[model samples]
Target: MYARKPVIVLLGLAVCGGLGCAQPPACREGQVATPVSAQRHPVAGHHLRAHAHNDYEHERPLFDALDHRFYSVEADIFLNGGKLAVSHRNLPWDSKRSLEELYLEPLQARVDATGSVHGDGVPFTLWIDLKEGGREIVDTLHAVLEKYPMLTRVDGDEVLPGPVTVVLTGDDKAKRDLVTRHSQRRAVRDSNDYSPEDPPADSAWGYYALRWGDYLDASSTGQLDASQRARLACIIENAHAQGRKVRFFDAPDHPDAWRVALEFGVDFLGTDDLRSLDTFLDGAP
Candidate 1:
């Protein structure tokens, strides 16, 4: 499915999907000459806008997404036997692959060892998709996160500068309780779609996640029509004006949709194809 385009100059590989394409095209000569090239960061030329959706499903889990330099990575978790287990759907629980083991522990260990999670010491988002056990999961998460205070902080409304910012999602009531009930917690709550129920954009805590197709028809229709592009612009503009970062989830995972996202100034580019997004950003201006 990926035997078309050749790898572009300065970009190491032209990726097709998560599995990557056959090495038909040769890698371009020389490394991408971004300003960070002089620095020692591993993901030197990576763009911070990329977001890894269902990151735990990958072969190397967090490391795979980190290798791509995605600014945000998400995992679905369930509270089982008082432990947070990382899994997409409710199935036979695996204690060995708990949230702590897959995400928190690795994150903390990496920061302790290198003083950075992404090799650049830059702060990034760790999105936790809470599946079940509502309050239990939220509480469990808070406790686990507290130990790594330096990496994940909590000071009332402010999270402070930290290596990672943990965002809680799922079960609107549970997420709200974490905020309204605690009054002071280290974690942040994911906002609902912009509506009367949701906090004002200025008051929105973490991010505004919406359906990409709702704004732009480009996903199914190939490229966005002029009107569709305008709709996207309006939505993005509205969110930003309210001081909220914008993300379009469930968008088409195609390159065409990705281009429109950049054009609309999207804050997060959600995709399962890390390699393709990584390749796209590497070659993009």
Candidate 2:
């Protein structure tokens, strides 16, 4: 519930070419700045929609989110010297946090250790936000991802079930390149806001992500107006109709905000508060 971890990324806009957009994310009021308790909460069960935004920033990166049984976790990566290095910024890139070391290898280990689809028996999403890229980098990653057949994959008209799914965000060029090079890959592109009325793109994209602050004009009441709710519902419906999951990233991190998202049938909950969100969803039947 710590307000400092603001929804910095409003996923509504499709990012492409490069990491050029630095527009500050839109914010909604009515969120009280409450400090997240240091006391850790025990895992209750799996939260399929829970996504750990900027998970690498946590003390345990993927492990922390995994402990809570979060279905998805995000990591920011920079392709440096033919190696994908995981870091939030360039100046302090740590070689020890390379994507292979931190995410890929660990994920493969988990998959190998398990007899189920995912190591833990549920689908896990590893969101890789590339800070920079080139064709070779995508090629390298494609090769690396090949070892894990347990990851969901797209083969022509069919999609095979896998334990883990890889999603590429942030840099748009690399995303397009990845899909173009490997049409039948375990990874998919995470793209911007789209409406049902809009003509659908190719099947390369897997999710329609948006920043809620851009669409809804909510008041301090902590509820969306009927018209607002209807608008959101239509977007969700349209995305689902297109076989795409819908995620809104920049919504306020509050119980009311979460309740509204759940009611609107949001497919993913963008959160940094893994424990709090899991606690909230854990109570759901």
Candidate 3:
């Protein structure tokens, strides 16, 4: 017998025996259908803003961090009898480095030559940790800043125009209060180590900085003490609520502190080894 052959049939039925197929709505003339959701492009992740603390004390000066694209740089300034000198510690011989020669002038030249902040398009922050007590330093800084409009300011909620961000650091509570009362200068507070009542009255003058004790230790498995950690968290939250950013210094030279700061989403992380920190921040294994 011959092999049997199968047959296929096609059917186009608008309505079945007991049911009808539903048809999609037709668009009106010259009209398009509405989409459920609009297409969205991806946004870039926030770039890490790194600062070189006490940059002038380094063997190579500001070039290392500037070359590495740090977003902020700090210089500790001590007002001598007549001039603003850069130094981490007050010493006679170290007084040779003036704020103009070691930092301001060179920084001005670099900004002019590159037409960039920290060699980037956006303006970089310059934190001036004042080690002096006289009004002369504050006046000098004000005058110097007049020449650089791009400096950053720390008003409670007031936005001031500038590129370089100047922060006054020291123990002169009287001078700090005076500046806070009169000028647009910013002040630094110890977040991890300071008392709860150390913040300024205006709140804008309350820029908190983290100290060494704020982080967990390698041997401790990144576990900060309960009270200290809680204080740090509260400081970060409170500062953020009041339109302030928290910066940390004197942190451990390990990844634990860095990770903790990152976890808490602190604003600025001050590191001596910018390259290492940058690498770690990039998620290097």
**Top model by lDDT, which number?**
2
The residue-level lDDT of candidate 2 at 19 comes to 41
The candidate with the higher TM-score, 2 or 3, is: 2
lDDT of 2 by residue, 1-285 (tens): 212211223464322224443322222222122212112223324277788888998899888888877878888887676677788886555677888788777787787888442454667788888777788778877887787777788775567767788888877899889988787787888786564455554457887667665555454423666545655666666666567877776677776766776766677777888889889887753
Query: What TM-score does each of the candidates earn?
Result: 0.78, 0.78, 0.67
* Cα lDDT over the full model 3: 0.54
Ranked by lDDT, the better of candidates 2 and 3 is 2
Off by over 4 Å in 1: 1-46, 195-204, 219-222
- What local lDDT does model 1 show for residue 271? 91
lDDT of 1 by residue, 1-285 (tens): 112232222343334344444222211133121111111225544367788999999999899998887878999987878878888887677876788888888888878887778667777888888776466776787777777764555566555668887777766777777666665566776664553223353222757766553333443523665544545655565556556777777777878777777766777788999999999888765
Q: Which ten residues in a row have the lowest lDDT in candidate 1?
A: 31-40
Pairwise TM-score winner, candidates 1 and 2: 1
Model 3 residue runs over 4 Å out of place are 1-47, 93-96, 113-115, 153-158, 174-178, 181-206, 214-231
Query: Can you write out model 3's per-residue Cα lDDT over 58-134, one digit (the tens) per residue?
Result: 77677777765676678887666667777887767444487777766767777677765544556656666776565
Q: Compared to the true structure, candidate 2 yields what TM-score?
A: 0.78
lDDT, each prediction = 0.67, 0.68, 0.54
